[model samples]
Target: MDYMTLKEASEKWGISSRQVNYYCVEGRIPGAVKIAGVWLIPKDAEKPIDGRRKNIL
Candidate 1:
């Protein structure tokens, strides 16, 4: 399984690392596991449902 760090996931998702952290905290994004002290995002994790709805902005 491919995994991405918080930074990589953030950049790929067009969001901030802080926002990814928040999503992790809120349990929005599944397949996010904490390895060591950092959050690793699974490459196969579900994408955002729609492009129109976003908490950002």
Candidate 2:
């Protein structure tokens, strides 16, 4: 499987690297793995939806 660094994932997902790290740390990112203190995300992994958002009507 292909993998991407946290930075790449952050850029592609349009989110802060810190947030990606947090997601990885929190196990919110599926197929995300930590290697040598760095986070490796699956290249095909879809960005998780933010649960903190509320729908406005």
Identify the leading candidate in terms of lDDT: 2
Score each candidate by Cα lDDT: 0.80, 0.93
What is candidate 1's lDDT per residue for 1-57, written digit by digit as tens? Answer: 789888998888887889888787777888888878899889877655544577786
The alpha-carbon deviation from the true structure for residue 14 of candidate 1, after best TM-score superposition, in angstroms, is 0.8
Instruction: For model 2, name the residue pairs that clash.
Output: none
Report model 1's TM-score to 2 decimal places.
0.74
Show pairs that collide, candidate 1: none
Question: What's the true lDDT of residue 48 in model 2?
Answer: 85
